[model samples]
Target: MSDLEKKVKQFIDRHKLIQKGSSVLVGVSGGPDSLALLYFLNKHKEMYDITLTVAHVDHMLRGKQSFEELLYVKNICKDWDIPFEGVQVNVNEISKESSSSIEVIAREVRYDFFQSVMKKRNISTLALGHHGDDQIETILMRLTRGSELKAAAGIQVKRPFATGTIIRPFLCVTKSEIEDYIKMNNLIPVYDHTNEEDIYTRNRYRNHILPFLKSENKNVHIHFQQFSEQMLEDEFFLMDLAKKTYNKVVSKEKNGDLTLNLIEFRKAPFPLQRRCIQLILNYLYNGELPKDLTSIHIDSIFELIDKTKPSGQIDLPQNLKVYRSYDLCVFTFHVQTKKPYFLNWDKGKTLELPNGRQLFMKEGSVPDDIGQNIFILDENTEFPLYVRTRKNGDRIRIKGVGTKKIKSLFIDLKIPHNERDVWPIVTDQEDNILWVPGLRKSIYEASDFTTGEKVILQYK
Candidate 1:
């Protein structure tokens, strides 16, 4: 067996990439790497007890040339007696319509075609020809672009796709090894001229960075592959830990809001803290992170938590809000401005406030003690009291503090920004602010409990 073949076989075995009697669908682009992988898999099909089917995509970028490349792959499949599937996607048109780059659209359509073929053939394994050099370039590119932790680990050798698994067996071999194999087999492979151009980021990395790294160390690809594998393994273990810690420290509400316990989260290790934040974001975004959500947002969350102030908030992509109030951090998509509400309090009836609190006014003798939530009014006081949300320029008279604006009271009490809008405020018939429920009572509250009949206003 050739050294490249031996290396790939060992990699597949070590990773448990394929099972015996598996139906494998190979993605071929008529390139040297993919052509070599197809030849190697076809040569050892009987030994591995696997069936082979070829899937090709014509990302109609080069017009006729791209279609011809697809035909070449189909012809090769026919010569090898392997089943063939091909697709044509106008990647340029799709890119324009989707506002995505040509390379991203092409990759999306190619993978979509590959998965369709796998599902049609009931294939359990889908193999791609991503060599070791590709792994190095992917890691470097992601790091340069400030990708998140898991993304910086680079392309996984094996991951779940559709109803089966996608495997990259050639990740153990370098690009030069694939070229050598193609030459030894006298194979003719079509080249994409775009790959040689420096317009694309990956091509620039391939043209310059790769040669420099390889010159310093001939086996640099091997070291990079090992680094990728190690990173993936560590990420897997840490993510598991983070998930468990998340369950302990994060609470998901019925309305899809997330409440994180900063105390318990801060107790966790630093790595797990970052991962827990990632878990929260993943849950909030339904596992589909927005493209613009980079590590900077995650750092912002950390900064919010570490700040000495007890309360702050930061807006994230997609209208999400991260609020830190005291030891509690909340992640929510609901940032609707609370509508100002004003409701008249009918005698002997309960009024429900917008913040889910109940307020009632009843005629009775004053209790011996008045709490912050209860306000006693004399019979001669203002009639037709009202309960409403705070309005601009709202103020109340305190016993010792004199007049204080409602906004200043909320700030002094360290109320969360979102809650300050909906906090219930009590007013008399003349629009005079009387009491801030669960907070302060205005000086208008009847201090002489012994006088005549009394009106008791209590908040629940």
Candidate 2:
């Protein structure tokens, strides 16, 4: 057996990615990596007791070159007596419609097409040609971009796909090894010109970063791949513990909100806490992590949990909010456009805000121990109190200071851009801003508080 075949077999046996008598669908892009996978799998099909089928996706970004590559894959499959399936998609249009990058949309389309072919062919596994070098690139990318232990685990060897499994048999091999195998077999593999361009992040890593790293350490690829393997094992163990902790401490509400028991959640280690947060988010999001939830978000959650305050809230990606109310920490998915909210609050009544928070008004004295949730204003200031979201040109005057724009205050507080629009702004009947929730109180009329009548605003 050839070295490529031996490595492929060893990888399959080690990962148990393929079963005997299983039908496999190979993604063939006509590039060296994929072509090599197709060739090797076909050569060893009988030995593995498998049948081979090839799937190709034409991204339509390269004009005629796209069709040429599709023909190349089709003819090669014909030559090898393997079934060929190809689909055409306008990746540019899809990218624009989905607001995603061309590379991301193209990969999505490719995988969707591959799964459709797999279903039609009754294939139990779809094999891709991601090798050790690709794994190194993925790890370095996530590392430079700030990743957690699970993200550092890099590309998995085998993951569940549409109806079967997606396997990467060449992850144990390198690009040079695959090239050597192709040369030994006198194979002609097409090259993708786009890959040679360093515009893309992966290409930059492949063309520039990997070379520089190799100069310092000759075995950098192997070392990084080994590191990924080690990290993956650690990730799995932590995830298992997190899953158990999630079942114990997490409760789903009738309205799809997830509440984590703070008593139990705070007792867990920091690592499990992070994973538990991620696991709950994935569960609430239908088994997928929100793309915007980062390590920073997770760390911020830990910080919030450690705080001595009775109630606090933090904004997360995808309009999700993690808030501590009394003894429970809740994760709420609020995906709605911010609309101007105007409500009138009578003394001793509760006013609802646009974000589902309530502000209770009561006739009381200004207590010396008033906390952040309490706002004291003159009761005779206005008859009907008003509450609304921020609007353009909204300015508030500080005590003994000039008027400042609410936007500037938000910038000073380091409020994220997405949360600023929906942040509640409390105003009087005359439209004088009184308080900004979770932020500063107006203090605009501090001198006017000499009156005996005062109304206390408490947030709930």
- Among these predictions, the greatest lDDT belongs to 1
Model 1 over residues 1-460: C-alpha lDDT tens digits?
Answer: 9889999999999999889999999999999999999999999999899999999999888988889998899999999999999999888888877877777788899888888888777887999999999999999999998777778888899999999999999998899999999998999999888889998999999999999999999899889888888998999999999999999999987668899998899999999998999888888899988988976888899999999988888999999999888888889898645888878876777887766568887888888777898888745665567888888898998989889999989988877777888888888888888889889988888767886777888898
TM-scores vs. true structure, each candidate: 0.82, 0.71
Provide the RMSD of all predictions against the true structure, rounded to 1 decimal. Answer: 5.3, 11.0
- Candidate 1 lDDT: 0.88
* Reference-based TM-score, model 1: 0.82
Which candidate leads the pack in TM-score? 1
Worst 10 residues of 1 by lDDT: 377-386
- Candidate 2: worst-modelled 10 consecutive residues by lDDT: 444-453
What overall lDDT goes with each candidate model? 0.88, 0.81
